[model samples]
Target: MTQAPEDAIDVDEPLAPKFVAATHDATGEQVPTRDLSELAPPARPARRWTPKRVVITPDALDHPHAHRIVERVEARGIEVERLRANRLTGVRGATERETYALAKSTMAIVVSPPSRRKLQPIAPSADWRVDLAEGCPAHCQYCYLAGSLSGPPVTRVYADLDDILGGLEPYLGQGTITSRRADRAQEGTTFEASCYTDPLALEHLTGSWTRAVEFFGQWEAPVQLRWTTKYDDVAGFVGLPHAGRTRVRFSVNCLPVSQRMEGGTSTVPDRLAGLRRLALDGYPVGLTMAPLMPLDGWREHYGHLLDLVEAAVDGVPDLDLTAELITHRFTPGSKEVLLGWYPGTRLDMDESRRTTKRGKFGSTKYVYPEDVMTEMRTWFTDELARRLPELHVLYWT
Candidate 1:
């Protein structure tokens, strides 16, 4: 096994110690502080200011997983106030019932189930849209979840796996159901896992992803379990029972963008190393260059990235290289949240080029116009073909 280099980017250095310690304590282990740093960071600081009152409504407390998480929070020396429905109105925003429902649902299933209800039925897709958690531990400015949820950024673990798995048994038993459209036939039943949370960051605690991997291993039909993450941790997946049913995809970007926007996330080089490891372990590894930020010297930046990827796993005899690319898009609410999160974020949010969809949806006018897109597609396709001809170029969205 190839080891991550000593000089490889250390995105977890700042918070690793705290998270590691917390995890050990939660599991009832007395790990030395020094040892915790070597493994993983504690989830939060050892000493934090306690709110005068930490309130959780009755409805929120009803979910077994939510109650466990709340208990975990309190155990860490934080003062928590459990409030019934009557006290929720004093909290803020939506009604007590609405707030409780959202909190309960969000924390109910640690893993978000794949939505069988397809937004685009013509395409091949997965029924389970599992959202294991909300708010990534890593702070990436381009995160799509910013617009999808309502709350502060947090890493919430859902402890009830039996409930989640019980709900998914029916869908997994169904055989290969191909989409009617010709374009969708190639890709079938896709589970979008990393949209709201980074599966790897909290895998040590929840192990929900590993459970999914085991579940899919026994699946009879062809199911594509897609997990997209910017984390470089692969220790949990090295020898798991993945059985090729799960595609452990890494979301990558140019080095500059990664350093600037994807703060607290693993560097590009480290991520590539993890990908190489997964590939060597016989996992179906996919590469996603998503929300491809348009930056100065874009071509040169991407060129270097492609070069690094080619070199990372170039001669690996038994590896599957599937690459997917997507440009950036932002809903109005997302933009508002992003602007607030990153007051002086440098990304270009030009409006003229973007077309307004349903009044709220807004994306780049054309991340690349037809001419640019054609050039980019050709460049990427040609390079991958020349370097790794046997690999599959999954999609260029």
Candidate 2:
């Protein structure tokens, strides 16, 4: 097997293993049980760029925002291979054989990074963003992935997580290096998982997030593993080895938005209930009110949501009351992709007051002006401070 260059696994100290293996029966056949230690980790799969029978268009791979994705992937010592997806089909219709074939034929793949160009760097909050899966199943009308992914939504788990983690082992012990910095108050590094996919949507099938929860538990300085989702699948999370480091954040919208815009996603109330259950089980739970949609009666809609959140997790212990709020914005290039994906989407498409640049554009087009942002900030700050005074208000940007 060809080894990745030394810079790929750049750390001086040898780190402890962070994963363990278990076995179960495959179908009805009894499988031989062996530890992961018994076998060498699998090789990095080869990348194949086979063109499909369907007619290929230049627009398929010509995403204006592809450079951002290339930069992110290449920074990690991985190469990006752009393939023309010959076929586009809903994942639900893919047969078991087809699914297996797709998995076997691919190495590492990259997609256009989603969302508004400038994600307001809300102060250092989440410790670690965990990437459990690569795509989401739920179809929110305003989904960032619509612009990010090239084809229909299909959740893809990088089957070589063991290898990825093995590659990450050397840097795991560097937590103490930052403890010596004088000017900076050092905390654990934040792993932003689900930046490309929703962790809980197809978690039952993949069990990748569960494996992550277990892996992050053993680290010494306690890296924060943050997973956000619109799904309310809580059964897999109950009593898992989360070790108080894994924060299960639910991405919620008002009932009106949920009803009109979000498709195949859990209701806001059900997601709140899931958060409550996780908080009660001593897991760190967070609330993310992202892509804050501006529609008629918007204040009333968000007000009701605030009430629901307070009612659910007010007295719950270890509940991380740190909420994130981002308004609707889109780059011109992404707007074309998004509108193409969801033609009837009611996302604010008025490009009047947006910042224009080479490939990115977004509505600094505030649903409400600076005054509204001030008012909303004040209202949330006061209400959260009053209800849960000790809870850390991690970030508001």
Candidate 3:
């Protein structure tokens, strides 16, 4: 048998060993008492692109947004799969990896009620998290959803946007903030909207985020709304009466990384354009310089990115911009899922060069070596301070 490349994954091959019972006991004759035993679980299918075909549960039709989604999708001449609530599992592939891929890319409108569980606390930045959706359509190679989301991460837009937004009222003014935060503009109670999925990509489909922004715009409190996106669909949000309450942060990276690793998402320039637009529209804009991979010539590339950012937001008066720096890291399970999703990807997720550390959630994640981490932090902090003096860095994690 041929050895696969260290970074390559064969999704078609099962990761676990299969078990089969012996047909004959002792002698060459078949044993009637013996039965075949199934042991190994089925292989996980590979993720494919399938955005046109949408699957909505029958209950989803009861929601107002679901009707709009169906109309908009149908207007574009797309196919809709109206499945029974229980039959939703049929959308997921059982054997072939390609079918699994399709499931990941399919747009599934879930008209389910928001979780009744208490909102989870997200310290350092936000007080609580509200889920308008579960999965993202963007097939970024190093997506965190690979491990966090369950099987076949089809993008799901909640039908109960009104209820979800209303649930945030009691949680207002209940979040804590870092006193030393770079940007005090977001100093009060904060609610994170993009904790699970990027809302911009689905904004056209569900308009949940648009409604959320409008809700926050009319809300009179110290509370703030924050969400990050790798997309540039800001047309719907530009004219909202946000009242300086919503912080729109664009997740960005160097050109090389953005073009190579972040698949099925907007280009760096487009995201920057969105940033500029939001800033110009008097919205508190921010940047999420995330998954900062330390690739070859990384400093030069990152510096260039900052330069582009400087140019994009240059002369935008009162650009209340903030940034968060997050270096690239991944858990073992996420790496496995990402590899299965994109077996031929060129992402350098080699564990040999990484340091093992337990994340806050008790999952083991692979981060860069100490020297590399230090270099990255130092370089980014200095570069941002030098190139974009107006931008405040919220934190580096």
Candidate with top TM-score is: 3
Candidate 1: segments with Cα more than 4 A from true spot: 1-128, 172-188, 353-368
Residue by residue across 1-397, what tens digits does model 2's lDDT show?
Answer: 1324544532211222222222212121223233332222222221112211112122323432234323433443444444456333333226544542343233223221333221222234442233434665566777776556654445444444444444434443243222223322233555666787777664543456776776666555435667787876675565555556667888887788888888767778778867766666556677787777556787788778878887777556435555666666666556776565567777676765444333235332224456556776787677767765655555665
Give the Å error, residue 384, model 1: 2.4
**How many clashes (backbone N, Cα, C below 3 Å) per candidate?**
26, 13, 3
Cα-based lDDT for every prediction? 0.57, 0.53, 0.73
Candidate 2 lands at a TM-score of 0.63
Superposed model 3: Cα runs more than 4 Å off: 1-50, 94-96, 112-117, 178-186
Q: On a 0 to 100 scale, what is the lDDT of residue 330 in model 1? A: 76
> Which segments of candidate 2 are over 4 A away from where they belong?
1-130, 170-187, 353-372
Tell me the TM-score of model 3: 0.82
Cα lDDT, model 1, residue 96:
40
Question: What tens digits encode model 3's per-residue C-alpha lDDT throughout 352-375?
Answer: 999999867788989899999998
Highest lDDT among the candidates is held by which one? 3
Alpha carbon deviation, residue 106, candidate 2 (Å): 15
Each model's TM-score, in the order given? 0.68, 0.63, 0.82
Q: Per-residue alpha-carbon lDDT of model 1 for 121-219, expressed as tens digits? A: 211223346555555656567767766776654344554444664555455423333322344344445565665677876554345787777776666
